[model samples]
Structure formats: structure tokens, C-alpha cells
Target: MRLKNCHNFKDFRKLAESRLPGPIFNYIDGGADDEVTYRNNTSCFDKCDLIPNVLRGVESVDMSVTVMGQKLDLPVYCSPTALQRLFHHKGERAVAAASEKYGTMFGVSSLGTVAMEEIREKHKNPQVFQFYFHKDRGLNRAMLERAKAAGVEVLMLTVDSITGGNRERDLRTGFSIPMQLTLGGMMQFAMKPMWGINYVTHEKFRLPQLESHVDMSGGATSIGRYFTEMLDPTMNWDDVAELAEFWDGEFCLKGIMSGADAKLAADAGCTGVILSNHGGRQLDGSSTAFNQLTEVVEAAGDRLDVMMDGGVQRGTQVLKALSLGAKAVGLGRYYLFPLAAAGQAGVERALGQMRAEIERDMKLMGVTSLDQLTRSNLRFR
Candidate 1:
């Protein structure tokens, strides 16, 4: 299907599947263990229904929201994921340009293919740096300093991924930094020769963010090794609190779930906390972000800007999260699959479809602005 005909998240996913190699596609699409969290992330939204108000005049809609000191024209922002160039040659550049065009924030992963400095220099919109606490304290500090120097608007430390999740799909498909394809995986790549050609023709795969600190250029270090060997599992609130004080601007924690944790984020000087399960990439059966939103919002909503992600697919889903108290929602695989399908054009098309869906849903709900939504406007089924 053409980009214009792409109706929902699954449509863009199909487009990406048709365009990319099976192994590479699964790396982005698959989640840990039985993938229970992955399936439920979006499905949990079905449990809640919107009770619309009819009399309100809905002539003009204003979906703009300011979260963590960044003003987003839309209520949804792109969450950072690693290995973008593997999905599309344009990589983070494609995502940055598309997010800027939509006037939203875009995150750059610590493992992003494009350099943070390059994205900062090119895009005028807000940029977030998704960081990981490393075993080497000096390295972690240096990375933060680099991001600070790049003038990133937010510093999001991902706390859930101290160790890599058990992604069985990767083992079966042989997905890695420098792919070591099994026989089955090689056959899958052969089916998509264009992806292989484009991958080779483009600049060789490199994690520009980690280039200075890590020896990723040598191809000896695998992603699994980086997480298992480098990331510090002993990371605690005190450590992050100190980092927050050090960052000193728009600091947020990215993997928060419980009300207690949310409150801790607020107390630790975090401006915001994202209720996420790392796209279900870590801790497979952990509660979906939507399922735990209400409690977390109640705990820290007044003190901190609360945002959520995982399973957001429709405009109504975005509306539902906002109604429940999320200042904004986040998109992970939503834009990634589109980027894999057709680079910048694909992501732009996906964003356009999402915008239309949100606008149409708002008009149907008889609301002119996002703030008009509240928990009372929803009924749980």
C-alpha cells in the first residue's frame, strides 16, 4: 500500500516488513520472552472508552502541549530507539526532520546511528538525549557532558535496561550490531536484496554516539555485550538524583511504572517521568504503561509532568491517555516501522495520518483543545 493509503500503525508495519529483511525487521518489531507486554501495550487502551460531550463548540483545535520545558505542537512525541540506520539509510536524520516538520520533540538514543551534535546543529526543534548509566562512571559523565555541550533540551536516563532482555527472536534470526546471519536469516536477507544493497551502499554502520568512548568501530563488541558488560545494574535513585543535579536542566526518568517510583522521580529533581516498559523490550511481562497510568498520575501529576508510551496506535488512544492525565504520549515503533519502509517520506506520512486521526477524533469528541479532556470524560469497559 502507498503511504497515503496507510490507515493505521499496522499498515505502516506491513509496509516496513515488505521493504526490510526479515531478521532486521524482527529486531525492531519483536519483544522479549513471549512478547506478552508487546501485545498488551496497545491492547490495554481497549479497556477504556471515551464518553464524548456533544454541545461543546469544536471549531478550532489546539493540541499543543509543553512537557519538560519543550513545547510540542502535537500531544505525541517520538521516543528514541537504537539502530535506526539499520532500518533506513536516513536513520536519526529522517526522524529528526520529520519530527521538526510536525513541531514535536524527537529523542536520540545513546546508541543512535547519527551524531547528537549533527542533529542539534541541523534541527531547531527540541532534542532529547536518551542515556544509559554505564559501569564506567567516568564514561557516563563524559557522555552526559557531550550531550550537554550539544545543547539537548532533555536528558532521559533509561533505568530499566541495566541488562538486555531475553529477545528470543534475535537469537533465532541472528540479529546483532554487525549481523552474523544464520542460514535461515541469510535466506530472509536474500529475499530482500534491495535492503542489503542499500545497507552496503550507504555509510557503513557505526554508533556515532558511542564512537569516542567505545570501540564499536572494531566490530568486536556486540550490543548484547554492551548491555551485559557495560551498563551498571547497581544504578540507584541516589546516583540518578546526583545526575539530575548535574544535568541541571529538564531531567527525566524514562522507565518508571509505579506510583512510588513516579513520586521518587519528582522528589529526585526530575522534571518528568515517562511511564514505559522500554517498548516491552525489557521485562517482558511488566505492566503496560497505559494500565498503570492512573496511579502514577495521581502520585506525581501535581509535582511533575507525567508522560506515557507503549501501545499507543490511534488518535483515540492518544486522547485516552491525555484524558487520564498524561501531559503527552510517546511513539516508539509507530514511526520506526515507517522509517524502515520509506525513510523520511514514510515517517512524514505516518505522522500525517496520526495528525488527521487525532484531529478527527477531537472534532468527534466536541473538544477544541486537549485540556478539555479529563478522567470524567472516560468510562472503563
Candidate 2:
């Protein structure tokens, strides 16, 4: 179960489960309601199959792709997830560094434990700042200005999470921000003393992205309250359009699933549209981003980059998405579990494995570059 033994997604997940407490592991593993969408995120890839060609020169494979105006050496980038510090003491710092080593983009969430400025200063690779729309206009503007000042390469506004999803696992385990675990949950943490020791030994956990605007000092506020009270649930296309114009750069809309929404993202002047269902963390029965990819690409691909993330566990799955016209793919738990397993080294290993898988799969498919992948290379079941 050590880092060296971790070669794929399942191995990293098992190692992380063994290393982390039950509640913390579930926080990364659980989904909203019945957890159907979460499971479907990966299962949707099975509905389509890849068709390989033989006798095509493919000794050298180039997996590079340009999505959201960012050139990624691998077609997959690390999607943003909250509370990285909670999972690993190194937090966003580790993810940013590992992704930088691979020459790809890494997203920093508004709920990220580390500040975007710190990540921006430390990493030379392309960075994305993923934030939510706040109820207050001034707060939203301030967040945008802060990210812009930090010189973030991409602005990914998560459009789906106006209100938090009904995460039953959190309720059962009492895993809320500021450590509101139930009695059983408390016992689980006690079972994993190593995690507690690591948590206490590291730097204090604070949502650096929102520390100034939101008063989280002295246990005054919690993440649940922040989502319920701070986020603007009524956010519409107009607000997003203004934010896109304000960012005025490589702006993208994450959590996009439908063709209509993708078209709206293009009309709003977004540079890319990421087809995600928040890793099935929100809207339990919502369609998997992969299921909606072709429609969205047809609707808006001509105008903007169409990317997808969810259930992308294998390199062959990444190829399937690309063959269907995804500019790039995003990885959530695929990297998070590795981060939890062994910090920076674990993340680097996961990224390296993915790159190797993509390279091998590309050669097997008789393609030397990503552009060689097309709908013709795929067969839907």
C-alpha cells in the first residue's frame, strides 16, 4: 500500500483510504444523494469503445493539447477540489508543484486551503483559479480582481454550485468544516492518530482564498454556512457574461452539461466549457459530462474549447473523450486519492502513470498526435 506500489487509480484510492480517517476518505469518495452520478461519471466511458488502426507510424506520440488557451503537455489537467489541506498537509502547494513538473494546468478552488497568490508565485506552469459567484456583487468583483492580479492563466467559474448538494455522507459522519464530526466520526478520527498528528504538525488550515472577505477566524464560520449564506443561488447567464468580460482572458464555465448551456457559454464569450457534474458531488441524477460531450461539442465547439471530466479513470477513456471532440479532460479523485496517499510524490506518480498510459494508448491506437483522434476512431455501443 506504499507509494511505490501505487500504480493506478484503485491502488492510490486504497492507499489513501488506509492512510486517511474514514470521514476524510468519504469526503473525497462520496457523492450527493444516492451516489449514482458519482459512479456514472466513470461508467459513462464504457458506453463507447475505441477503434484502433494498425500499420500507422506511432513510435513517437505527442499528447500535447491546447484547451482554454493553455498548452498542456498531457490532455488532462488537475480539476479543482476543495480542502486539499484537509486531505494532505501540503495542500494545493503539492498539487501545483506536481502538475508543474508535468507541464499541465492545475486548478485552485475558492475553498482551497492555500492562497492562489502563493501557488502563482511558486509554479511556472499554467494555473486556473476556480471560484463561485457570491451573493454580493462586490465580493465577486474582488475575487475576480484578486485572481487577475495573481496572473492566473484561466478563470473557471463553477456555475453549478449555487447551493451545496445533499451530501448524506457528511451528515452521517458529521464531516463539516471546523470539525463538526458526530460521536462515531470522532471515534474514526481517533482511530487514525497519524492523520491527526500530521494535521496538527502542518501549518494551520484556513481558506486562504476567502479569509479576507469571509470571517473564518476564531471558528466564527463554516464551509456549510459559507455555501448557504454567501453563494448566489440565482446566478444566471448575465452575471457570467459580465464576469467573462471582466476576466477578459481565457475564461471557462465548469459544470456545463447540456448543449444549450454550452451554447450560452460561447455566447457569453467564454474561451472554454468544461463538461462536469462536479464529480457527481452535486445533482445526484444529473447526466454525466461524458454523456453530454458530443452534443455540447456540436453546439459550441466551433466557438470555444469543449472539455470534459468525470469517470476518467483510464488513459483509454481519455482517448475516447478526445476522439469524440473533447479538447482536454479534467481529473478529480484520480489525483486527489494519490495526493492523500503520499503527498507530492503520490501526485507525481499518478500524473506520470496517466501520461504513460496516454502515450502507450496513443501508439496502440496508431496515432502520433492528439489531432489524429476523431469520431471515425470510435464506435458507440
Candidate 3:
């Protein structure tokens, strides 16, 4: 299928699969070993049914939400993922522009292809810098300073990825930073010549965020190695507290899945805590964010914003999370697939569709504003 024919997440995913190379597409599609949690993230939504109210005059809808400290036109924002340029030549630039047009927050990954400074200079919308705590404290502090200098509105520390997950797809495809693809993988890339052409014709791929400190050249460092060797496995509440103090702004902890941990984040001065499992990219069989939303929200919702990511494909899913008490939701592969399919335009199309879905679903549910949604609107099956 083509971008024009894509109307939903699955359609965009199909187009992306057809256009992108196997390794690249799988990078965005695949989760941890077995992918049980990855599949369950969306499946859990099926357990609960929305009880819509009729005969209400719903002429207009307001989907705006303020999470962390930024006001978002939509309840959903783009969560940061690594190596966007590999998925599409436009990379973070495409995602950033689309988020700006949609008036939502866009996260810049520590492994993002575009520089935070450049994106900050280009986009006027709220931006978040998603990074990890490194073994080198000095490096972590410096990166925080850099983000502060760039005027990033949020600092999201990904606490779950102390180490990389067992992504068997990458192992099978032999996918790495420098790309030591197996013979079969090489054939897959060769099959998609258009992707290769665009990849080669564009500027050389580089992780601008880590290029200054990490030597990623000539396969000297792989992402797996970076996580295993560089990231601090000993990161604790103390470390997070220190970082939050240094950030001293809209700070949040991504990858938080437990109520107690969410409370700790609130006590540590976090402005928000994202109920995420790294999009099921880490820890197979872990609880989906949707499944853990209520616990996290109850524990810290009054203290700080409780947001969630993973398995958010439909607008109804966004509403369900909001009704359950999530201040906002995050999109990962939802927009990435569209980006891979048609670059910037594809992303905008996906965002526009999502906006429409939320608006229409809101009116149908007899709610004009997000505040009207409550736990009473849901019935668990």
C-alpha cells in the first residue's frame, strides 16, 4: 500500500514494511524476546470497553492537555526513539516539523540523528530530551547542560533500560550500528534499492547526540555495547534525584511501571512519570503501560503528571488512558511507521488522522473536553 491509502496504524505499518529494509523495519517493529509484553500493550485495551453517552450536544472537542509543564494541543505526544535517519532520510527533522504542525511535544532521543540544538533552533514547539544515566557522571552532567542550553522543555530519564533487552530479531538480522548484516540481511537491503539509494544519497548517518563523547565510528561501538558498558546499571533514586535537581525544570522519569516507583519519582522532584516499558523493547513479559496506568496515577497523579506510552494506536486508546487518569499519552512506532513510509508528509498524515480520530471519538463519547472523561466511563470485561 502507499501513504495515501494508509488510514490506520496497521496500514502505515504495512506501507513502512514495504518501503523500508528488513533490518530497519524490524528495528522499529520488533520488541524484546518473545514480545509478549509488546503484543499485550495494545491487547490489554480490549479488556476494557468504553461506555459512550448519547444525546449530548457535542459540537466541538478540545483535546488539549498539559503534561510535565508544556501544553499540548493533543493528548498524545511523540516519544523519542533511536536512529530515525535510518528509517527515513528526513529523520528527526521530519518528526519535529510534524509535531510542531500538530502542536504537540516531540522527544529527541539520546541516540537521535539530529542535534538537539538544531531541532530547538528550527522548531518552536515544546521539545523533550530523552537520555539515560551514564556510568560517567561528568558526561551525564554535560549532556544535561547541553539540553538546558538548547532550551529543551522536558528532561526524560529512561530508567528501565539499565541494559539492553534480548532483541532476537536484531540477532537474526545481524543488525548493529555500523550494520554488520548477514548475507540474508544484505539481500533484504538489496531488495529495497530505493531505501538504499535514499540512505546513501543523504548525509552520512551519525548520532549527533553522542558523537561528541562516544566513538561510534567504524563499528568501534554498538548500541548494545553502549547500554551494557556505558549506562550505569547502579542508577538509583539518588542518581535520579541529583539529575532532577540539576535539570531543575520539567523533569520526568520514563519507563516507570510501578506505583511505588512512581511515588519515588514524585518525591524526588519529578514533574511527571511516564508509565512505559520502553515500548516493550525492554523486559519481555513485563506489564504493559496501559495495565499499570491506574496504579501509577493513584500513587502520584496528585503530586505530578502520570503519563503512559506503548500500544497507543487508536484515538479511543488515548481516551481510555485519559479516562483512567493519564494526563497524556505518548506515541512511538505509531508515527515512526508513517515516517518510514513517506517521510515528513507521512508523519503529518498520521498525526492528522490521530487528531481527527480523537476529536470524533470524543464527540461520540459525549465529551467535549478531556476533563469530562472519568473512570466511570469504562466497564472492564
Candidate 4:
């Protein structure tokens, strides 16, 4: 399938699968062991049905929302993922430009291929720097300072990934940072020569965010090693509080899945809490973000913005999360597949389709603004 034929998340995923090598595609598609939560994240939305009203005279619909001090024209923002350049040569640059066009927030991962400073200089939109708390306190402090200097609008510390998940697909394919593809994986890449040509023709692949501190040369550093060796497994609320205090801006905790943790984040001076399961990449049986949204929102929605990401593929899914009191929703694989399919243009198409879907669904729901959506309009099955 070509980009022109892609219409929705599934379509973009198909296109990406066809365009990308198996190992790379599986890296984006696979989840933790058993993959139960991965499938449930999107399916859980079906448990509750949207009860829409009619004759409300919906002429204009506003999808704008303010989460963690950033005013997003749309209710969905791009959650950061690692190593974009491997998927497509445009990398974060393409994602950043598309986000600017749509007037939404974009996040740059600590493992992102593009430099955060360069993305900040190039884009005039709200940007988030998603980083991990390192064992070395000095390294963490320096990364925060760098993001602050780059004028990053949000600081999202991923709290769930103290250790890497058991991604069996990567293990089977032998996929790593400097890809040690198995023989079968090598054959898959050979079939996709176009991807290889583009990958080599573009700027050399480097994790600009961690290159200064981590030595990833000669295939020495795998992501698993990065988590095991560099990241602090003992990170707690106190450490997060210290980081939030230092940043002293829009601070958010990205992997919070419990109401108790949500309350702690609010007390710890976090401006926002994202109820995420690392896209089901870290935990196999953890509750999907949608199922856990109401509890977290009720726990700390008043004190801090409660947002969610994972299994958000359709406009109705976004609306369902918003109706439950999410400040905003996050798009991960929803946009990444399109980026891998056709680079910047593919991303633009996906975002544009999502925007159109949201606006149309808003009118159908008989609401001109997001505030009109609440539990009153929902019924659980």
C-alpha cells in the first residue's frame, strides 16, 4: 500500500509494514511478553459507549486544550518514542514540522536521533523533552539544564521504565541500537533495499540526545544495556520532586498508572501526570491507560492535569478519553507508523486525518467544545 491509499491507523500501519524491514517494523509493532495489555489498550475503549446529544446547533467545534501549561490546538499530542531515524531518515525533524503544522505539542525522546537543541531552534511550537532519571545525578542535572537552555516547554520523566521490557520480537530478530540482526533479519533488510538506500544517504544515525554522555559506538550499547547500566532503578518520588523543583516549569510524570502515584505526583509539584504503560512495551499485564484514567483523574485531576497515551487510534477513542476528564490524549504508534510509511508527508496525512475525524466526531456529539464532554455522556457496557 502507498501513502495515498492510507486512511486511518490500520492503513498507515499496513503501509509501514510493507515499506519497512521486518525487524524495524516489529520493533514498533511488538509489545512485552504475551502482549495482552498491548491489545487491550485499544480494545478497552469499546467497553464504554459514547452517548451523544442532538439539536445542540453545533456550528463550530473547538478541539483546543491546555495541558501542562501548553495550549494545544488539538486534544492529542505526540508522545516521544526512541530512534526515529531508523524508521525513516527524516526522523524527529519530520515529526517536529508536522506537529508545528497541526499546532500540537511534540516530544523528543532521550534516545531520539535528532538533537533537542536543533528541534527547539527549528520549531516554534510547544516541545517536550522525555528523559530518564540516570544513576548519575550529575548526568540527570546536566540533561535538564540542556533542555531548559533549549527552551523546551515540558519535561516528561518516564517513570515506568526502570528496566527494559521483555520484547521477544527484538530478541528473536537480534535487533539492537547498532542492529545485530540475525540471518533472517538480514534477509528482511535485503528485501527492503530502498529503506537501506535512504538510511545511508541521509545524515548519519546517532542518538544526539545521549551521544555527549553515552558511548554507543561500535555496537557496544544496546537499549537494554542503557536501561540496566545508566538508568536509576531506585528512582523514587523524592528524586522526581528534586528534578521537578529544579526544572520549575511544566513538569509531568509519563508512566504513572495508579491513583496513589497520581496523588503523589501532584504533591510532588508535578503539573501533569500521563497515565501510560509505555505503549504496553514495558509491562505485559498492566492495566490499559483508558481503564485506569478515571481513577487517576479523580485522584489528582484538580491538582494536576491528567493525560493518557496508549491504544489511541481513532477520533472516538480520543473523545472517550477526554469525556473521562483527560486534559489531553497522546498519539504514539498512531503517528509513528505513518512516519515510517512516508516520512514527513505521511505524518502530516495521519495528523490531518485525525484532526478531521475529531472535528467531525465533535459535531456529531453535539458539542462545540471539550468541556461539554463528561461522564454524563457515557455509559459502561
Candidate 5:
């Protein structure tokens, strides 16, 4: 019911559901068409079992991992999501601060409500600029240059989402930027007066990430248009390679789901590849990232730091991904729901719980450090 009561992902989700309006909650909860991929993202983890070797005299646990040249205290980082301010007034501010406290990396989306520069100035942790290849080549170059100037440590280009997925939940609820809410959607907002009050009472809502380049006023651009009209559907390895060369730092691909593509990412000079399906928000019935981690790791793990983000709900799940050779994992809704339930406090609690879970699970698994995990520590069902 409250922040303190929120002990895990499901707890945070429950709290978020209680606090947020119907349309807003569904936006975070829903995925592509039937959401089968979204459900499987977590369910796939069930097929893989963690074979812990107990009684190894494990006392203190070290769960640190280095990915994309950033050393993270925990193996999990907050995967970027858009419209955080709408979920909680603190927006990306809370997420940035919490991730810093945990000594891990956190990403800020191109559609993030807060500016990357502002977050950069506040925290010393490695920050990611989640880039989207746009139709305007100049805009793309400018955005990359801007992040370069701001000193972002990593460039995570989301390759899968050339266009937005078919999210039917938004259609039913009428959730949009300026809120062309249907009668039912308006009523849902009316019921959550506290959220509205907090929203209005705090800073005015605006996507500082894209306000300068994109005109969002007068209902000109919603997420739908931003994807269909603005993003470049012609994006390819050449484009990604050029961007990686331009960055000339730690560059990662976020939507790669196949081993061949992971190999191409390595050949393209990418430092890392994250097996993700856009949290099942883009493509439905796609293979879960967890299911594809082994193939990817086998194909490109030697050359590129292979990571994944999907359907991870517990510390054991994180361990499972690591056992399969994921350099790290990214957390999306696991942190967003808590951000919605509370503000910085909520995020901090969620990260704290995750750290504790990882540590506890590591000790229980009879491992003192992350290197102790291996494919030998797993049994596939």
C-alpha cells in the first residue's frame, strides 16, 4: 500500500497501480498488440533454473559488473523509459539519483521528460544517452554531438523500434501527450486528483530531451507520430556503425535479438549488445531476451559485452542471465512502477531491495563474486 510496504517488483507495481490513473498505469503495463512477448519476457526465465552450489564458505558478496566500459556495483541498471514526469513529478530526476546511490549505470531516453545535460551535471555515475535514429540526418548528428559535448559515457541506440508497436491499451484509454482522452480516460484522471495536483504543482510537463528539435505544442507530435513520421525506418548497420564511429566511446545496441545481428554489432565496432524486445512494447510474440541470451553470447560475447533486459523480476533471474553469460541486465518496469508509486524514495527503495536481493542470492548460491557464475550453474527445463 505504501513505499515501505513495497518489497519487490510486484509490490511496487501494486503500489503504482493504486496511485496512478487507469490510462497512465496501462501505458506502463501494456505492450504490443496481444502482449504475449511482454508476458514471456519474464516467463522465459522460468524455463532456466539456477543450480546453486551451496556451502562454499561464502561470506561477503561482490556483485559488480563492467559493461560498455562502465563499472557497475550491481549487475542491473535502470533501462530508460519515456514520460517519467507523468508517472511521478520527479521524473528522470528520481531515477538518476537512485541509480547513483546504487553505484550503477542508468539510461535517459530521447523521449525522457528531463534533459540529459541536467542529469549529467547532478550525478557522477555513468549515464547513457538512448539515441533514436531519426528521419532528419542533421537532427541525428546534432543529438549525438550534444550528448558528446555533455560527456555521456555510453550511446545506446534502440535499433528495433524504427516505428512504435501496436499498443492497443492506449487506443482504448486515449492516452496521448495533450490528453485527447476519451470519456472513460478523462474519468480515470478525474479519479486520481492527487496525481494531477502533483503534476500541476510541480514543474510544467515537457520533454526537455526533444523540446528544441521537435514541436510538441498544439498537439503536433505524440509518441505515435514521433515514431512513424520522425524516426528513420531505413536505419541499418551502416547507420549504426557511423553513429558508433561518431561517438567513438562506449556504444551499445539495445534491441538486438539475434546472434547474427550481435556479430554484426561487434563487426560494426559496437562495444556491447543488449538483447531486448523493447520490453515487449514494440513486437509481440517475439522471443524473449532471456531465451536468446545464450545464442547471442555464444556468437558475439567474446567480442562484445553481451547484456539483456526483459522479464527479470527477482535476484535469481539476474543470476540466471549472468549464468547464461550476460555481462549485465537492464531493468525497465521494475523501477518505473516504484517511481510512480513514490518519488525518489520509491526508486531508492526499489534499488535497495534489488541490491539486497542480489547479494542475498549470491551468498545463497555459494558465490562470493559474479565470476563464480557460469553456464555450468544452470539447468534448462
Candidate 6:
């Protein structure tokens, strides 16, 4: 199927599966052990019901929202993931242009294939730098400085991934950086000949974000090693607080789950907290972001901008999050699969479908503006 046929997350996912090698596709699609949290991330929305009101004239809907000092025309923004160029030749470039067109924020992972400076120079919309704390303090500071120099709007430090999760899929498939494949994985690659041809024909994949800081060339750094040996498992609130103060910019923590942690983030001067479970990639069986929204938002909603990511697929889900006081929501596979399937066009189509869904749902809910949504509109069952 092509980009035009892609109507929802699953449609784009199928297209992406057809286009990418099995090992590469699973790297993005699969999650932690048993994939429990991963599955719940999107399915949690099914537990709630949308209470819509009719007969209200929403002639034109205003979906614009401002979060962490950046204005976005839509309530959802792209969540950063690694190894983009491996999925599509355009990679982050495709997502960047689509986010720009939609006037939404787009995050670039610390392990992204594209360079932050290049992405910054190319895209005018808000850009977020998704960072990981390294054991080397100097490297951590240098990364912050580089992102600051690039004029990135938000510095989002991922707190949950001090060490990589137990992703059995990667182990079974033998997926690693620089395209190391097991015998079984090699056969899967051979089966998808078109993906192999496109991958070979396009420019070689490189993690420009970590290329200079880490020796990824010559097979020096594997993703597993990067997590096991390089990341600072000892990272604490104090270190994050100092970084927040140093950046003196729009700072956000991307993996806060509990009310206590959310309060700490607010106390530490974080402008925002993304209630996520790393898209169920980092932690298994952790509570879904949507399920914890009310508690986290109640604890820190006044002091910090509360946003969430996991399991957001439909526009009504986004509206539910907003009605409960989420500043915005994030999209991971929602856009990534589309990017992998048909590059910018696929992403735009996904965003277009989302926009229409949000608009139609908003009017049906009898709201003309985003702020009109309130807790009174929701009732948990």
C-alpha cells in the first residue's frame, strides 16, 4: 500500500513493515519484554469514552497550543526516536518538514541520524533536543552546549533510560547499530529485497548526533554497549537540576510517572514534564501515561506544563488528555511508521488525518477552542 491508502496508525504501520527490513522495522515497532506496556500505550484509550456535545457552531476550530514557550498549531508533536535514516532515506528531514508544515514541535533524538544543526537550520518550527545523560560529564555538558548553540527550543532529558530496557526482540533478531544481523535476521533482510535495495542505494546511515562524541565508526560503539557502559545509571535529580539551571531554557523531563517525581520536576524548575513510559520501549508493565495523567497533572500541573505521549493514536484521545489538563500530547509510531512508509508525504497524510479528526471531534464536543475543553467534559468509567 502507498501513502494515500494510509489512514491510521495501523495502516501506516503496515506500509512501513512492507518497506523496511524485518529487523529494522522491529527495532522501531517492538518494545520491552513481553511488550505489555507497549500494547497498553495505545489500547489505554479504549478504556475511556468521549462525551461529545452537538448543535454548537464550531465554524472554525482553533487547535493551536503553546507548550514550553513554543507555539504549535496542533496539540500533538513528534516524539524522538533513534536511527531514522535506516527507516527512510529522508529520515529526520522528512519528519522535520512535515512538522514544519503542520506547525508542530519535532524532537531529534541524541541518537538520531540527522544533525541537530542541520535540522535546526532547515526547520522553523519548534525543535526539541532529546538528550540522555552520559557517564562522561564533559560529554553531557558538550551535548547541552551544542543543542543550545543550535537554538533548540526545548531540552528534554529522558530520565527512564539510564540503562536500555530488556528488548528481547532485538536480541532474538540480532539487531544492532551499523547493521549487524544474525543468520535468521539476514534471511529476513533477503526476503525484503526492495528495502535492501533502497537502503544500499541511498546515503549510508550515520548517527550524526553521537558520531563525534562517541566512536560509532569502525564498529566501535554498539547500542547495547552505549546503554550498558556509557549511560550514567547514577543520574539523580541534583544532576538534572544543575543542567536545568545551566541551560536556563525550556527544560522538560520526558519520563516522569508518579506524583512525587512530577512534584520534584516542578520544584527543580522544569518547564514541562512528559508523562511517558518511553513508548513502552524502556520499561515493561509500567503504568501507561494516560492512566497516570490525572495524578501527575494534579501534583504539578500548576507549576509545570504537563504533557503525555504513550498510547495516543486518535484525536479524541488527545482531546481527553487536554480536557484533563495536558498541555499537549506526543506521537511516536504514529508518525515514525508513516515516515518509514512514504517519507514526508506519509507523515503529512497522518497529520492531516489527525487534524481532521481533532477538528471534527472538537466541533462534535461543542468546543471552538482548545481551552474550552475542561475536566467537566470527562467522566471515567
Give the number of the best model, judged by lDDT.
Answer: 4
lDDT of each: 0.90, 0.91, 0.92, 0.92, 0.90, 0.89
Candidate 5: residue 90 Cα off by (Å): 0.4
- Candidate 5, superposed: residue stretches over 4 Å from native: 219-225
- Over all chains combined, what TM-score does candidate 6 have? 0.97
Model 4 vs. true fold: TM: 0.98
Please give the RMSD to the true structure for each candidate, in Å: 1.2, 1.1, 1.1, 1.1, 1.3, 1.4
Model 2 clash pairs are: 41-311, 42-311
How do these models rank on lDDT, best leading? 4, 3, 2, 1, 5, 6
> Looking at candidate 4, what is the lDDT of residue 212?
81
Put down candidate 1 lDDT per residue, 302-326, tens digits, no spaces: 7889999897889999999999899
**Which residue pairs in model 4 clash with each other?**
none
Candidate 2: tens digits of C-alpha lDDT, residues 240-319: 89998888899999989899988898898898999989888889999998889889999995898999998888999999
For candidate 6, the lDDT comes to: 0.89
Q: How many collisions per candidate? A: 2, 2, 0, 0, 2, 1
Could you tell me the lDDT of residue 323 within candidate 3? 94
Candidate 3, residues 1-381, lDDT tens digits: the string is 777899999999999999988988888999999999999999999999999999899999889998887999999999998889989999999999999999999999999999999999999999999998999999999999999999999999998988788998988897865467999799999999999899889999888898887877644356557766788999999998899998899999999999999889988989999999888889999999988888888898589899999999999999999999999999999999999999999999999999999999999999999999999999988
The true-versus-predicted C-alpha distance at residue 98 of model 6, in Å, is 0.5
Compared with the true structure, what per-residue lDDT tens digits does model 4 show for residues 296-323?
9999958999999999999999999999
Candidate 2 lDDT score at position 74: 94
Q: Which stretches of candidate 1 lie over 4 Å from their true place?
A: 220-224
> What TM-score, computed on C-alpha atoms, does each candidate reach?
0.97, 0.98, 0.98, 0.98, 0.97, 0.97
